[model samples]
Target chain A: MDGFWIILSGTLIAISCGLLGAYLVLRKMAMVGDAISHAVLPGIVLAYLFSGSRETIPMLIGAAVLGVLTTVLIELFYKQARLQIDASIGITFTWLFAIGIILISVFAGQVDLDQDCVLYGEIAYVPLDLWFTASGINLGPRTVWIAATLLLLILTFIYFGRRGLFITTFNEEYAKALGLNVAFWHYALMGSVSLTTVVSFESVGAILVVAFLIVPPATAYLITTSLKPMLWLTAFFGFLSSLGGYFLAVWINGSIAGAMATVAGIFFLCVWIFSLIKQKQASIPFRA
Target chain B: MNDKTAIEAHNLTVSYNRRPVLWNVDFELPAGQVIGIIGPNGSGKTTLLKAIMDLVKKSSGYVKLFEQDLEEVRERISYVPQRESVDWDFPASVMDVVLMGRYRKNKLLKRLSKADRDLAAEALEKVNMLEYSNRQISQLSGGQQQRVFIARSLAQGADLYIMDEPFVGVDAATEEAIMLLMQEMKKEGKTVVVVHHDLQTAKLYFDWIVLLNTRLVASGPKDQIFNEALLQEAYGGKLNVLSKVGELIKEKDFPVREK
Candidate 1:
């Protein structure tokens, strides 16, 4: 039952990240997600410190606000300050994450969070934090419910905003000419990335969340020729990686988040090899 | 609201980082004619088109499309940006790309209707790209890609077509096909404005030419304004006497004023 709950939680997080990740990959903004996951660290830390509690709601609010701030800061640095994108992302996330680390270390005695857990999440501990009534009706872990709600929210956004996202990602100039608010779609996408990161950060940590946010969609990119297929394939790869990684962790007695990322990486490698072989086969007839 | 004028720009100026690229541009393009925007490198030809399309933030002055504000006439305008502007590796089929033209009419949150799909197909057929409708955009050749873009513009069903360097890097056959499509659009009483690079072919392709070089050098009918003096002014003496004569040779078949 513990294993079942853990895998379910991871899969939920994976699906949420995977759906949003397809758009990120399409827009070539995968690194933006990386930057947001890290930059939201300080916000999370500040929420914990100011509230004097490990409440999920406050931390999520902080992470969302900081996620938007990170995007705004990156834009300001690159557009107004004339910094390169890489430089902008680098400066913003590192400083913010450093502040988070310092705050955690400074208040180590009071804070239940640690730097190690921030890097590689504690999914194993997820089952311990149960949300139930006084009658002892089991409502499952808070992380599971959070991940499920986030996944639903992400899916809803994708369903309603599919055309807007498609047009914006495919061509911004055309989208602009069509009278669509390109900036709104852009920030809305970044908003989804933030929400997914914040909700998944507790289950999979910041670093591995980047993997779930990028790898599945990237793997889907190799196999699919269109956006719809890529999105469906991304969710499939995300679920497969989560389920496979969970069992692999059980067998090897390793970190679940790390093992899940490894599984995603392995899937990417397999797809790459398969594509290369297909290309070679097609070229052989021409050579002959 | 001048019914005869398709586009009118007055005192238009655009700059990048405070350095002016297009300066004091004034011109009026007539409706139902194929117009060419010709200029040398760094002459802000593309900038002028972007300004008219409202794609770039103009430093000064105003532009009117069909004698009204750009925002009001946006749906009536179709823009074919440079081929190199977008990523060809984008995961979308040719049909999908063309269907984007229908997005303006379909609007957000509304699925493209069956009529929209038929219009996309008919647009593709117009460009002879209907057979490759299902193919991914990345698999297309340079010329085929240009055709697909034209097909997309056709799907837009706009009154005015603004294309930037559409003929660049395309095969001669594709060039002819696009020219025929432009002429067909003209027959349908739609106006086309192209940013053309080749001075030799400019004479044959466009009936009206707007010579640009950081400003409006001259804009008028081909016979009225396609003269050596205007060319010299637009090119800024870069084409010396010999090259100027060479241009005469290239344009010899067409009766050009030697002055």
Candidate 2:
């Protein structure tokens, strides 16, 4: 039963991140997700400190606001200050993340968080946190519920905003010609990434969250040629990584989040090698 | 020329980082002619097109399409940006990209109807890309991709089509095909404005030409504006005296282009 909940949480987080990750990967904004995941640290810490309780809503709001701000800052620097996008991303996230670390250090007593919690959340503790009714009926682990809700929200956002997301990502200039609000779609995706990062951060931790946000989608991107199939394949790879990571962690008696990220990396490597071989075979036959 | 103005710009100036790229440009393109924006590399031909499409901010002046504001007539305008501007490795098939043309202001939240898909297919057929509709954009050659972009613009069903350097890197066959398509569009009374780089083919391809070098040098019918003095002004002293253009301007039969 405990194993079921742990794997379920990881899988839900994986699918959500993977779905959004596909867009980020296609946009060449994969590292933006990583940047947002780290940059929202200060917002997450502040939200937690303000709420003074274990709650998801406040943290998500903080993440959303900070996430949009991070993108806005990146854009401002890239456009206004004439900085290259890569430099803009690198500078923005590092500055915000540094502030988060300072906040944690300065308010160590009030934050009351173990270094392990912030660094790489312990996934094994997921089943330990349970939500119960007033009638004393145990529904399930609170972490699983949070993961499920976040996934549902992301699914809804993707479903309704499909058209806008598609054209804007494919061709921004064309979309601008069509008079579509390109900025809206851009910030919407960024806000969602920030929320996903924080929600998954509580149960799965930062490394695993960043890993799922990029690796599975990138792996799917390597093999698929179109968007629809690429998305389905991303979800499949996300689920596969979760299941494989659980077993791998149990066998090694090591960190679950670490094991999950490692498995995702392994999948990426194997797929990459297999694809290179396929390309080589295809090219050899066509050579004159 | 048609009674309706296709594009009207007055004192249109665009600057990048406070340095004006397009300065005090004034011109009015006719509704049905094939117009070319011709200039040197940094002469702001693309900037002029972008300004007309409202892609860049103009420091002064404004552009009117069909004598109305751009916002009121967006659907009547189709913009084909530089072919190399978008990432070809995008996760979409040629058909998917073409279908985006059928998407509009009103259909933002709904699925494209069967009629839209049929129109997209028809556009692909016009470009000889119908069979390659399902092929991923990443798998296409430069010419094929350019054709797909034209197919998308065709699907737009717009009155005024603005293309920026559409023939920059295409093969000879693709160039011929595209020229034929443009002629067909002209026959159908649709307006086309292209930012052209090749001087050798500019006169033959465009019915009218707007020469630019920071400021507008001249804009008129090709026969009226295709003079050595105007060309010299637009190109500064960079015009090659022994080039084919000089011979053509002198009304001498230059050697036939190698087929």
For model 1, the local distance difference test gives 0.87
DockQ of 1: 0.59
Tell me each candidate's TM-score.
Answer: 0.93, 0.94
Residues B124-159 of candidate 1: C-alpha lDDT, one tens digit per residue: 999899999999998998889999988888898899
The collision pairs in model 2 are none
Poorest 10 consecutive residues by lDDT, candidate 1 chain B: B250-259
For candidate 2, give the lDDT of residue A178.
Answer: 87
lDDT of 2 by residue, A16-134 (tens): 99999999887877888778877877877888789875466786677667777898898899878999888999999999989888988999889875545554567889999999999
Off by over 4 Å in 2: A48-57, A107-120, B1-3, B241-259
List the lowest-lDDT window of 10 residues for candidate 1 chain A.
A114-123
